[model samples]
Target: MTITTLNGVTLAYDDIAPPGGAQRTVLLLHGFASNRAEGWKRTGWYTAFERRGTRVIALDQRGHGESVKSHDPADYGRQNLAADALALLDHLGVGRCDVFGYSMGTRTAMQLALDAPDRVSNLVLGGVGGKLFDPPRPGAAEAMAQAMGTDDPETIENDFLKSFRHFADEQGEDRKALAASSAAVSPPLDRAALGRLPMPVLVVAGARDDLAGDPAELAAVFPYGKGKSLPGCDHFSAIPHGALKAAVLDFLDGIPDEDDFPPFE
Candidate 1:
């Protein structure tokens, strides 16, 4: 539950270590509107990774959870979001770490790897797409802003409930904030930009995801990226899907021996 103050924001994150194991840390960035607890711990991912001997650091991105909120739409831009992540790493005194992001967080994590390639050792991106774009829904921006502006228990819980069962649900208050975050400005990445990455990358998606394009099409964007689509699952539920999770862990373990970076201490 410790909070780190960095770049004018209080990043609430959970740093979890194994029973008595490695220092290598995997930074977990949750999707939009959702907080760190729901994205990682509540979903059973935190325990899964910890059991694997990899320390996990799950972050509540700015404007969500206990983090600072910026009224300026531009400040919520993807670049700034990515910068916030790097700043958190610096604040933690972590030289390098593995990263795993889902949906909105996947985009942010990808931008971080691109912005600071040397600082990233490995990446596992789930519920991802080839390009960064706003989800298909009306009044998306307004819904997201409302979520950021308030921390009402009922409102927040409602938002999470709405997003459940879909890989990329884009409705309700939290969904609206996510849509707003994506719609506020230009996308952080362009087509073909993902393929140029020299690092090992894993691209994941659900077979039933409506928000993102085809999994094969999305995976085609990354040279080293491999796609795994989970059948009978949608955007939100895909993360918890057995097939999806295994695909991610397998990809992370498949990184070339020499290029692998140690987890954070």
Candidate 2:
């Protein structure tokens, strides 16, 4: 793990290469309250992409993992975090690469693509669905923050927050930091803005994942985006499943081709 200052905040990241090196790389961003390890390494995504001859780089977003933890809500937002991704790429002298994000990471990845369209060749967003296009409302983060702020997980009323409380406990995350992270002021993205993304994109979600919104509906917003659902999986269990891996690999391999697109009138 290497640490660097991005916009005056310390960020921890990992830049791992494949066996014979790779002509391309994928920058990965994990979901909220989660770090690179749980989202990528622990889920076997690191090995999956590496095996396909692509390098992997994952960052512990500001308040999560080993990155700088701040108690201020202003420090964590979509734009602020997106800048961190750009700084990391610049630090490594990377011009352009594929971006892969899961859950909350998908938002950050979207901002990255929008902010620096030239720096992104394509995007792979997982654990997300149609809800992204909807207005941002009070999400589970605040509830989860309060839930984790307390040591007793049994008191957590929300099933989603309860699962995260378990994960935070298992990973020994700093509860205070996570709580602050959850409280951070993150604004929702404009649905119309996504139409400006000038690259191909893939959105994957589990069939049973209500948290992901509607994958088919979400994919329809992007000019070249496609949606795929992993049958019989949910929000938490979707990424680590084999279906996600297969979907990602096939997309990168360009299996569908232009012929696969619905004919234009």
Top candidate by TM-score = 2
Best by lDDT: 2
RMSD of each: 7.2, 2.6
Candidate 2 lDDT over 1-265, as tens digits, reads 8988877789999999998879689999998778999889989998898888889999999788999988776788889889999999999989999999999899899999888889998898998988876655566566767886886899988887888888888877877877887777766676788877878899999999988877878888889889888889999888799988888878877888443789999
Candidate 1 Cα deviation (angstroms), residue 28: 0.7
User: Which ten contiguous residues of candidate 2 have the minimum total lDDT?
Assistant: 133-142
- Kindly list the per-residue Cα lDDT of model 1 for residues 175-199, writing each as its tens digit: 4444345447746376566678777
User: What TM-score would candidate 1 get against the native?
Assistant: 0.78
How high is the CA lDDT of each candidate model?
A: 0.70, 0.86
Candidate 2's displacement at residue 25, Å, is 0.7
